[model samples]
Target: MTLEEQKEIQQLKQWLMQSQHQAVISGCNDILRRTREDMRVSQHILKEVLYLKAVAYRLLADVNSAIETLNELISYFPDYARAFQELGYCYLASDRKRAAHSFYQATRFNPALLTAWLQLEKMYKADNQSQALALCQQQIAFLTSLPRALLGATDLMHEGQLHKAEQVCRQFLASNEHHPEAMMLLAEIGIQLKVYSDAEFLLESCVTLYPDNDRAAAAYQNLLSKLGKFPDAVSVAKKRLQYAPESFTVKVGLAHALVGVGELEQAIDIYRELLSENEDRPAVWVALGHALKAKGDTREAVNAYERAIVFADDFGDAYWSLANTKTYRFSDELLAKMILLVDAEATKLDDEIHICFALGKGFEDSADPTRAFAYYERGNRRKKRTLQFDIAKTEKALQAQQQAFTKGCFNKTQGCQAADPIFIVGLPRAGSTLLEQILASHSQVDGTMELHDILGIASSLSHQATPYPLNVSALSNETLSKLGEQYLRQTRAYRQGAPFFIDKMPNNFIHIGLIKKILPNAKIIDARRNPMDCCFSGFKQLFGEGQEFSYSLNDIGRYYNAYEKLMDHWHSVLPGEILTVQHEEVLDDLEAQVKRILAFCGLTFEEACLAFHKTKRVIKTPSSEQVRQPIYKTGMGQWKPFESYLDELKDVLPARS
Candidate 1:
């Protein structure tokens, strides 16, 4: 009985053991299979979540998050140019154009990926010709000669060569008419040429396809405003302002419109408010300077422009404008204070140039040539490199222009007030503009601002537009005669009030020889200042529109040398046609000097000329404010403040010094 029971139990135990072993093997297999499935699901889930997260991040304005997600996705699938494009899209949306451009570079070609194409097109269209051209430059700069040619054309356009610019732009369009950028450029060319209707039409067409886009808006507004429908322009400006109120362009328009309708006082207030709200806005200050200068508050104008440069250190323009305003003749006391500032190391290049020039003029005004010369010499040498050349070039241009005028005027009909114009010639800071103001005060003489007519004739002689001809070595007698004719024809528009208009283009000294030949009836006044003070002032004061020569000292010196040679030439050839005014003599005795000037111009002396300081006139020169007030001795002997820094002018002064 015991053996049978034991055998049955053992059989049961064997059956249970076999079942347990099968169960363990089945469980292990199921676990391995399930683990593999779980991994596959996890990989898909992670990728999908990352993709959605990127999309969500972009929607939430988290550009960096979108970028990070795209970066992670690209790391897993490097062929995903879509991810690259998305990353670029995020960057573009963030207004990082340069970075977006780089990302766009990595995007693969896919015609169906219209977003990428549109983005690229927009980027290219949005940039300036020079800047946009830079993007394609590396790709095309070496590929074909056409790119270089295009670049040349672009530069010519920038320098105001409109016809040449149009020719180049047209040539570019001929080959690539549908190239959106080229189309946009053509539109710009139309805008520049004053074919505003054509430009407006083109821009409107562009907007129909790319509705509410920036480029179309810009084109429409720029063209509309330029046509002087300022109210419409302001309305357009407000539309743009609605979307981007902080845009310098839009704000400039608003400010300009306010200034345009004689709302200068309001414009000033707008600028002041803008500055208070955001002192970092440079354009606002620049606009303020213009308004204030127009209102005859030049000191505040200078200060506002100074603040503009502070906000935008690289803006050479603000420096130019500030110099122009502050550069007017300062009182001897003001000049002395400025000189002290320069000596104290608080003077910028602009400050030093202005003060030095003012000091020289002051000394001359005070009848002290020695001190005036010292200051002029210092001032000239302090100007920037570009400004020196400008001073010289502008003077030369004026001279050639003047001689051309004389020639042209003599040949004209007798009814045309064949009475020759008087030109007061000298370096800018040497009291030329000031002399013109004084001369202009006379009833018989009409002193106008710098004229382009003479330059036009000179340029005509040279076959160059705008700049006319020069007294350079390469002139023929026939060409010079034609230039003279051209000059006379151009200046006919300047006639007003008097038959004897004073063409007070001071730089006319260079071509006085030519002038003597053309207009035997003309009068020329050479307003001489101490060269040192003159040049120093030029170097310190930044001219607003042109005259890049005043930024450096070496250029100023070289310019002075050129002027001296030209003046010497004129004096030798023209004899008594030109009158010389030593700044010091005029300064020492303004009354006596004024009388002499009157006698020279063949005018009867008036009691009003004796009180020249009280004569109300539009003095557009730097010294307008000072000239409005009584002449003062505040500017004499100003060089003593910077006597320690006069190593640049130790003995380079004229022989008179």
Candidate 2:
């Protein structure tokens, strides 16, 4: 409200943070009394004041008083995670059994509660509950991966306060120089800031300093995998397994590494074994589903996903996995259950978002567009609140790419002559995966996952003061060729024995200039779709990672416009260097479009390309199931049913090309 009132709130928060519990309780009570008479304080501020009072009571060992205060606080704010956690602490001080339930509630509302995870882990271990203990371990992995200081910083990082989090983490590491968790946290911050070299160094040093920290080692291995160092990742996983053969975490790591190296059958075998050992592990079931789906066993994959749902009905990933199948229709009973869960306040936000999107698909399939649009909008709105995607920053970055990658810029530097890479780049849900499938079906083209080599290169390039394309201007010819070589070497593990490979990373549309400069002879395919259909499809899908722009209709439209303008620029400056594959054209005439794509890639027409639907492979994108089926025109205007809710998006889109 007033500046003085704001200052008072900040002072109260600072006192509470500093553990002046009694002082905070007294101060907050005085404010509450004055605000009650003045009627100036907001409800949210009042709630926070009460919450701090409850925390202070709990810290002072007044368990009953804390419980009463927390109950009152939660009556008004049922979704407050910290209040729930404090309730757990108070109950634990009295009765362990009740504490366990309270802790469960805390974690149920906020899965990121590290303290609750650790408490659950201890409670389960004491009760000799192996399955529950294992689940707790999974949750604790994230908490144990970071030091206390970094753990405290994660909230700030997630809130998009990156610089503040980085400063806090760095300050901790300054004194505790050898803290691996703090180093790893800094590495994570570096990644968020798009500085790959710094992140890599921090992770490597973390592993070197603390070899026994499996989480740090795993983080290092994961960083390697993200950078397309599949062979190195496999080596790291295997090394860990050699020491702790019984560690399920290491076994899972090995399985993931095997998948990265294109050992799909072996990965499936490992996942199956893990499931045999612990059938109650929902995460393992989800992993099995992914491996089976990648291996082209659609029936088994669906069964695995269903098994996960049976084990943990509230797990959002399981429901989203089933929805991502595209071909799987939710039963009427399942739809009703999902609707109930989506409406439940106790359901975790992540799980609720997944259930909402799944319900949207379910309603759409049942021909209930009104309900479907409501669910879709609800899910998108919920997710948009959690994201920190800045429209201005995205626009500026895209504009920098256009300005930096002029014809003269590319002509000044030449890349390697390696033409093995065939990139399918465009917005998500734009049929990029389908185009990749057709190309991968060719005898000479090995279909790989949406490899992150280009993004990794872009991140490495963005290590300077400026981001991405702006930093590209300072790179020399030697650096460009080296980057091209690095991409080829890093991606080697994903390839079979084929001479060419497909990298179907959709967001690579932003890095077309970098792609051209580093690998001048590489083939580039721009997968184009109807703007309404593509953006609407993305709005409905819940991606496991990345694609922050799809969470809101305005952001989605802004991204699509930026993508369209960038693609137009690429076409203008690099004429005849890129092929545009329109999704509607393929649906209209599959054979003709397939032949045209083959001709552009310098490959002869083959029946396999026309029958790409039958060429089964591991498809990781949202369009995974769609690409496994023959072309159809039904998806062309699927956005029409939801057009009434898309006026804001329509206002931002250009006229249909």
Model 1, range 1-657, lDDT digits (tens) per residue? 146434533443353345543333233334335545766433323333445456556656777867877777654443344555667768774565644553454433222233454566556666654564465444343224345545555545443455787788778868865444445556776766545556666765665555456556666666654443444555666777787778766666667765543456666776777778779988788778877775667788888877886786544345446545544444556556545654543234454555566566566556676776676666555553212134545566545544544323332222222445787777787777657767766777775556644533332244433333343324444554554555555555444566566666665665565555455456778888877767665554545434555555555666677677667655555556678997878789988888888788887777666556666543445666656656666544445454455545444453523
Model 2 TM-score on a 0 to 1 scale? 0.83
Instruction: Report per-prediction Cα RMSD to one decimal.
Output: 23.2, 5.4
**Which candidate number would show the highest TM-score if scored against the true structure?**
2
For model 2, state the Cα shift of residue 408 in Å: 1.6
lDDT of each: 0.58, 0.84
> After aligning candidate 2 to the native by TM-score, how far in Å is the CA of 438 from where it should be?
1.5
Off by over 4 Å in 1: 1-285, 298-417, 464-496, 513-519, 650-657
Q: How far is candidate 1 from the true structure (C-alpha RMSD, Å)?
A: 23.2
- lDDT, candidate 2, residue 151? 74
lDDT of 1: 0.58
Worst 10 residues of 1 by lDDT: 407-416
